[model samples]
Target: MKSRYIIASITGVSLSLMGIVGAQAYSGENLAKHAKITMTEAQGIALKARPGTITDEELEKEKGGSGLRYSFDIKGTDKVVYEVGVDAQTGSVLENDKESSHPD
Candidate 1:
């Protein structure tokens, strides 16, 4: 009985860990079908345009970049945050500007 309990506990923990990992890996997965460019590709493009560590990222439908864009907020080596938007369909850099003091 004790061994069975231990096995069940282990299984529960493993499932919980998998859920957390899956969540992180698929942040914008729902919007993926609408994007021609993959998230990994967008990340590379965003980094090149801003040259910083990505603090936050998401695939959102905004008023640019084929109406579907991958947005990234990167913290520069100089400690400033920049918002870079990449067109999901064309892989073009749509916006690369300093993040405003008041973010939307």
Candidate 2:
């Protein structure tokens, strides 16, 4: 009986970890909406910043509250990667910090 319980616990932990990993993979409508901006606009903004290659984009929830924000990853001219954030509702650029990356 003890062995059976240990096996069940291990299975449960493994399943929980899998759930976390899946959640981190970026699959959802909110994220899709944010990433759906026109490629022209994205390239225009990206050109100004001169972040090398655009990698990925997603919609992120605000930290202190409920709204949404758009974030994109870009390989910089200096060879370092960086993230950019824009307000989803107002279309205003918010922050360029890496910590701005998050799920909605």
Candidate 3:
């Protein structure tokens, strides 16, 4: 009886640990499992926010001490390069600043 109890306890603990791991894996915070917005969606949002053509884009989990966002470098027809950030969760523009004459 004691051996059966011990085995049951171990199984319970293992199941609990597996649940925790699975929860973490599926959490919205983990981009690999939950992507609120795709790269194409992010690019579209950035282009709309900056009114420019996206020349470069990257998925940023944490940038400059900020939360998950998509960074985009855009060049308008006027030749001004702009830096833009789209929130990964809400697909909103977080930052849009002119990044010198050079592109990032």
The lDDT values for all models are 0.89, 0.59, 0.76
Checking candidate 2 for backbone clashes, the offending pairs are: none
What lDDT tens digits, residue by residue, belong to model 2 across residues 1-104? 99999999999999999987866554233354554444345444644554577677666676622266656677677766677665555555565654344331
Question: Please, what are the lDDT tens digits per residue for candidate 1 over residues 58-77?
Answer: 98889965999998889988
Report the poorest 10 consecutive residues by lDDT, candidate 1. Answer: 20-29
TM-score of each: 0.81, 0.48, 0.60
> Where does candidate 3 stray beyond 4 Å?
1-32, 63-66, 100-104
User: Where is model 2 poorest over a 10-residue stretch in terms of lDDT?
Assistant: 27-36
Clashing pairs in 3: none
Error of 3 at 37 (Å): 0.6
**lDDT, residue 29, candidate 2:** 34
- What TM-score does structure 1 among the candidates reach? 0.81
